[model samples]
Target: MKKKYKERSARFRFWRNIAMFLPGVIVAFLIGFVGSDHPIEFQKLFDRDMLYIGSIILYLIIFGIASTYLFSSRQSYQMMEATEDEDEAYRYESQTRRIYDLATIFKGVMIVPYLLVIFFSCQKLIYEEKLTGILGKYTIPLTFLGLLLLTFGLEHQFRKTFKQIYGKAIPRNSSGAEVRELIMSMMDEAEKQICYEENFDIVFKLSNYVLPISLMAIFLVGITFQTDILLALVVVSLIYVYILVSQYKITKRYYKE
Candidate 1:
């Protein structure tokens, strides 16, 4: 019993450390760049053609993250269901699985905005060659959307994953060192599955979140860069309305069912 308890404690601490550290790592590494003031050699951007190339890089990063989340969620759920379970484990898995499914749907819905951004990013560089001249016009909102999905989606999934695995591993009636070891093995499998699900959901959610904002930026560029500001605004507004409505519809479907 003591050995089992120690092993479980060690495992929890490790995963807990990971759960806490990964987000901090992202914040520290990515956000830290903002304070660097070595004077960006604008000449580098010009010479390297980063403007065009950067778009591709951004898109690829977004796609990678989003796909990872989607794949992870489903894979984790399958892995979890493969293991032993109590009533709590089964219930927890069901809830977590559902959330993963919803995240997948949200990921798919994000495409509407992503394609728009690509279209507009291209429009500004290749088609129109005009700049928005404001990072807020595109980047701010994109960042917000990504953060929103990442924060809420990951937390929700993590809670579910932890609850299911932990709950299943230490049932009140179970006994014996060998039995405990078996439970430990099952817990390990469950943990892997949950982690995968969480990551997969994040990819799609993050991608979707940024996709809309990028499109919005593209629309804004049309207004800021060219002659048809009024028309661009109208088109942009309509697209915005469309996205909101789509989300509302999606929400209704899942919220009720």
Candidate 2:
């Protein structure tokens, strides 16, 4: 049984490594395909020098994905198996909270450009100008680059925190496994209780539908009025503003002051 589980784990890791690199390769291929004047032209570009550049890019992407996987594996170990010490667990929890805050900040920061994309896309559709060029030429690539940099920084933070909490002496007892499972179950229940009491589930579910419906309405109005795209975008931004404000209040209520 143990051998079979280990084999399955190894297989999972093998597929995960390939899945990580595949997205980068697909994105690069799509960009080449879309930017090429003709299919033959794009095909010809993949010769000796270009193949070397592509190989280098592929290696760099694989290196990045491998780095992320290593850090994430360390983080998983810290969360699940390495939190035996009380002081280490406390520090890990504190770091986890800060990481959550960092994630919120990252999402909040990214929302600006996302809203801008909506406004600009609508603006271009309404006014029929050269705004799509800015989006296609700069926004997409820069956003992708930004996410890669952010991922690197986040992994570094996790690595630093994990190293600080990592202990050499792991206490093994007959009841340790059972106790760990009980503790994890209790923590999961507590998190679920908090979410239920806070009505987070309702808010998220509502937002899931409301955001898309609001955006769709805005787009429809833009198509109708032809000059009211900016106005519609303004209305949509206001909806997001309300959502953000409500989220701020909820966070303030739930989190430490």
Candidate 3:
């Protein structure tokens, strides 16, 4: 059954790729259709540098969504194995899974304009215009804010759904396995009613999605803009390493007890 499901998902992903690309191509061409009579300054917004900047952002968004999918999928597999009740497991799985889908879809929407950015920037076969750094402008920060909002909502939504799916109270006095099950049940319930549009869920989703992608974006943008590439790389490396260390410490402690 698992193999069958995997096969089906592969097929779905195949079609989904096509679905992702077609709309993007169409939209890029449409946006690329700029007026010819505009002054140079007016045309500058649609010029090469801004276009590449937008492209970098779009790339970050796609990479972020894909990462979110993998992260959530790993989480789901673990939780599913940890879960005792099939119904509750499905609820948990779907809730977490949909968030990934939402991110993927949102990223796809972003890629359309990004392609146009590439088209416009590479028009003269060179990086001629001024490459504006991400912090120098407001768009990346604004999108970061969006992701922040998504991540916050995602966290709270899961917590809020705890009571409905699991017991009224978690089994504090029970065995560890029982407590684990109880918590998983509640978490699964929370996962079921996930709202991608909700402010908190958006925030929650953003928390997981943004950091890595932001790091990658930082590296890529820093390079393209001829800025502090080393700083960006160092920061991301430190962050990911810290997270890994924390995970190891927690798991070691959990098993030690």
Off by over 4 Å in 3: 1-41, 45-47, 126-257
Per-residue lDDT tens digits for candidate 2, residues 84-130, read 88777777665654454344344334444444444443443455443
Order of candidates by TM-score, top first?
Answer: 1, 3, 2
Model 3: per-residue Cα lDDT over 84-112, one tens digit each: 99998888767665654554465446546
Which 10-residue window in model 2 sums to the lowest lDDT? Answer: 165-174
Q: Candidate 1 lDDT, tens digit per residue, 29-61?
A: 554555443434433445223454454455445
Error of 3 at 48 (Å): 2.8
Off by over 4 Å in 2: 1-99, 102-147, 159-188, 203-220, 227-257
Which candidate achieves the best lDDT against the true structure?
Answer: 3
**C-alpha local distance difference test of each model:** 0.54, 0.53, 0.55
RMSD of 1: 19.3
TM-score of 2: 0.28
Q: Cα deviation of 74 in candidate 1 (Å)?
A: 2.7
Better of 2 and 3 by lDDT: 3
